[model samples]
Target: MTTEKLVSEIRKKHSFLCVGLDVDLDKIPSFLLNEEDPIFSFNKAIIDATHQFAVAYKPNTAFYEAYGIQGWKSLEKTIKYLNENYPEVFTIADAKRGDIGNTSSRYAKAFFEDLGFDSVTVAPYMGKDSVEPFLNFKDKHTILLALTSNEGAFDFQTKKVEDDEVYKHVLKTSKNWKNSENLMYVIGATKAEYLAEVRNIVPKSFLLVPGVGAQGGSLTEVCKYGMAENIGLLINSSRGIIYASQEANFAEVAAKQAEKMQLEMKTILDGIH
Candidate 1:
């Protein structure tokens, strides 16, 4: 989906929420295991229940990859279901893949052409050559890791490189890459304070922010500094929403959790206008 269309969906739904389909079999209700494909079954239920309240759905690749071939099948089914049923909802493959130019191109093709994801998460440690391949795919976004929502982020992201923080350098330098307009970024909600400085570097790029509910990040603080005129933030909630309840009524409970965030987002959008 185009950035404009994504923004349009955010406005139409009064939400920038991106539900994370980071399904772990151990965490999901055991009843789903009886189904032919437990992972896909669980994802379908959650997507159906929460799609209305969310503008995007991100399925972290690790969850599926851990299960091997069956996991890959489940992931394929999940994305196919979304594309067929809810084409308006943006899909992100949280793969965090980066490699040599030739290798990165294959990875890009796997997610963008074969898997049909609207965007894919990528690591930037390998520099422009590794990421430029992914950016070349028209209409597909390459969301580079900038400031993450993990305890280890301080190990390098916040460390000063000359005068500016390392992540700030990543944000500034990425703009010069090929097809950079298609680039988005991952900025953890936990580091909301750094958002103002982040925005000053790339005022228009979209940010896929994780670490909200489960991680105790402040949604209000994130928006206060990170929100752009277009509301360029896709706040994700995984465990907090999908695992709201592991009972038979899991989908219903997930919907309720999503609705709560959607309502808050609507209020924020209202104030923006």
Candidate 2:
């Protein structure tokens, strides 16, 4: 999907919420195991229940990769279902993949062509060469990791490189890469304080923010500093929504969790308007 379309969906839905489909089999209700494909079954329910309240859905690749071939199949089914049923909902493959130029191209093809995700998260450690390959794909976004939500982010991201933080450099320098307009970023809501600096560096670029509910990141603080004129924030809530309940009524409970976030987002958007 184009960035314009994504922005339109956010406006139409009155939300910038991105539901994280980070499905953990152990955490899901055991009843789903009886289904032919438990992972896909679980994801379908979540998507059906929450799609109305969200403009995006992100499925972290590690969760599926851990389950091997079956996991991959489940992921394929999940994406196919989304593309076929809810094309307006932006899809993100939270793969965090980056490699040599040639390999990165393959990764881009896998997510953008084969699986048909609208965007994929990428790591920036390898520099421009690793990231440009993914950015080269037209209409497909490469969301680079900037300031993450994890505690380890301080190990390098916040480290001063000359006068500015390293992640600031990543944000600034990445703009010069090929097809940089297609670049988005991952700025953890836990690092909300850094968002003002982030916006100053790339005012229009979209930010895929994780670490809200489950990680206790303040949604209001993130919006106060991070929100752009276009509302360029995809606030993702995974465990907090998807695992709201593990009972038979899991999907219903998930919908309520998603609705809660969407209502908050609508209020924020209203204030922005």
Number of backbone collisions per candidate? 0, 0
Encode model 2's per-residue lDDT on 49-118: one tens digit a residue: 9999999999999999999999999999999999999999999999999999999999999999999999
For all predicted structures, in order, the TM-scores are 0.99, 0.99
Give the Å error, residue 133, model 1.
0.4
What lDDT does each candidate get? 0.96, 0.95
Candidate 1 Cα misplacement greater than 4 A, ranges: none
Highest lDDT: give the candidate number: 1
